[model samples]
Target: MQTDPTKDIGSVFGRSWTLLSSNWIIIVPAIIIGIIAGLIAALVTPTYYMDTSGVYPVPVYHSMLGLSLVVGTMIATFVGMLANVVILTMTTGMAAAAWKTGKAMISDGMDALRRPNVLSAMLMLIVVSLVLSLLTLVTLGLAGLISLVVFFFLIYTIAAAVVGGFSGMDALKESFEVAKTSWLTTLIVVVLLGVVAFLATLLAAAFHFVPFIGPIIAAAISGVIVAFFSLVLVGEYNDLRGRAHPAVAAQPPFTAPPAVPPL
Candidate 1:
């Protein structure tokens, strides 16, 4: 396994930002797809109306599919999730290119979709999501903590698929190995990137009220954030690969030394 003194979570995030700012176009596809998916969802989802009763007005929900609302919602939701996966796979490819070569084009993103076994990667994602959902339900939400840990462990599966050309199941195994090798660092990356994503979402929410362009602007912002998150995952994957899994309580948590020396 390979390790570096200056490849900590902080530097991974810093490098991701640098790559993202320069290759902002990498997020265009994601933004476009997000808008399309949102429109599709809006068209398929139901709306609520105000029903005036004798003394009050109450909100009455109406599904476009009437009695089949649940089925319709599931189909719409699956389509949205599929769109999200496609966007993430493309962005991961672009982000991987940008991280490695300091540049990437939209075509590079498209090329990632052409990679063999990409569908398997998508299937693995669905499996993981179902597992997490089942865990949450079975444990009455106590499994939230376990789900987070599972998330941290498997977070790099798509990146591995994109960067290492691993198939879905293989990528999951690889990600687990890398996460085990640098468990602490992986945990930190998951938490910090999560925070950044949360903050970016809050910022993007402000763009939704800006008229016709609001959705576009919000999608762009969200696309950029998602791209950066994917980029950092690639970076961290590179940082942890080849390193031996640390024995519990045997070594200090991984921390890359700062780039600059303090006087």
Candidate 2:
């Protein structure tokens, strides 16, 4: 089916606004889930700084040192790749659950945690993340941009699969098909949303800079924005599947106003 990029964008944004206006109750649970997940990620992952020292010596020594460095780097790279797989798998499972409920935030996060397939889905995510990360690393940073593209595709696919009651592979395939049909438009929408998110973050940061009540307000704003995005994504998925959103359908048709009677 032909996809109308503009329509999809409109549907997503419209539904997002509607969700914010009327379904805020759902946002609370989702935000709680995000907070828990964020805390876990921050606590579990150790912060490490890489310190590199340069040595200048004879050609032979330099060559040997270079080979050693390369070998060590490769080994470390493989380990990092494995870690990425684990992280992505877990996050993807959470994302899938969120998508299934059409709430964007982790409304179903606890229930999703009870599912047997969540683990397997997370494993798949880890594998995909590792592969993408390695590719990006190999390309001297150009691959990073591609990785972002892949990340979004993967996220939508995982969410669709979970929501559509399909396997991870099937979901990934469908996402690719959708992306292929309207890649440029999809990219544009994503970029625009990202810019909006960045601005929101900046504004939140300004609030956070206040001496008191700053952090609390910033967190609240961030949570609201996250909720907004989640609903929008759900709406976008529905639109892609040909579902007619009430808001979109209810939009008043263009009409000319009646001419006033001459007085």
Candidate 3:
């Protein structure tokens, strides 16, 4: 298999950085939502202190676990998941705009959150999480390799939904088709992105002790980092879709639609 110059990992990585640097404002919505989510979490969760007995500072809860605690935990989990999906979809919209027209707008990101797109994204998230959890259990906590393969193939699901107007399972199937044709490139991008996210988490953790603003600062850092990751995914998705390949032949060829109309 010959490598396409346009799909070179270095080139794609460089272009992603260029887009991120030029369109840093794309992260504004993410930061805003992150802060809001952090505030909600702070208000809902029980107070705790860090226990330093271990090498890591483990959270120690003083409050007894009860009905309120369970309810709060559920609420926090739901909010966190919704916040992530929103950030991802918004970033996908902005990144597609940047890739297609050399400019990105927060409105473009908001526009991408149409009912069908949001519903599809939410379903995909739930299904994927369940699938991965099952795989983890079946593999006895050794599902990392299988999970990586799964993620590499489905990485473009949001981008496809936002850019190609695909939805639900169609979006996931489209991503898998595109990924298989460019397996090497997609896999490399996946591994690189995983590294970036890991590093970003470490960087964000450093802000955890800054008093009242700590969680806010950490949220902002995480939002920006994940937004960059989403941008790169969009870039790769567009590039892969633009090419002619047998893998995507069963469906109508992807074109840059004038607008992603609300459902």
Q: In TM-score terms, which candidate is top?
A: 1
Segments in model 3 whose C-alpha atoms lie over 4 Å from true places: 2-7, 47-64, 130-149, 210-217, 242-263
lDDT tens string, model 3, 37-99?
878987898665454567443323323435558668767766776787788888888888888
Candidate 1 deviant stretches above 4 angstroms: 1-7, 48-66, 134-143, 244-263
lDDT of 1 by residue, 45-101 (tens): 766444455343232233333545666676677777778888888888889899879
Q: What is the TM-score of each candidate against the true structure?
A: 0.79, 0.60, 0.75
lDDT of 3: 0.77
**Considering every candidate listed, which one attains the maximal lDDT?**
1
Candidate 3: lDDT of 223? 69
lDDT pick, better of 1 and 2:
1
lDDT of 3 at 3: 57
Give candidate 2's TM-score: 0.60
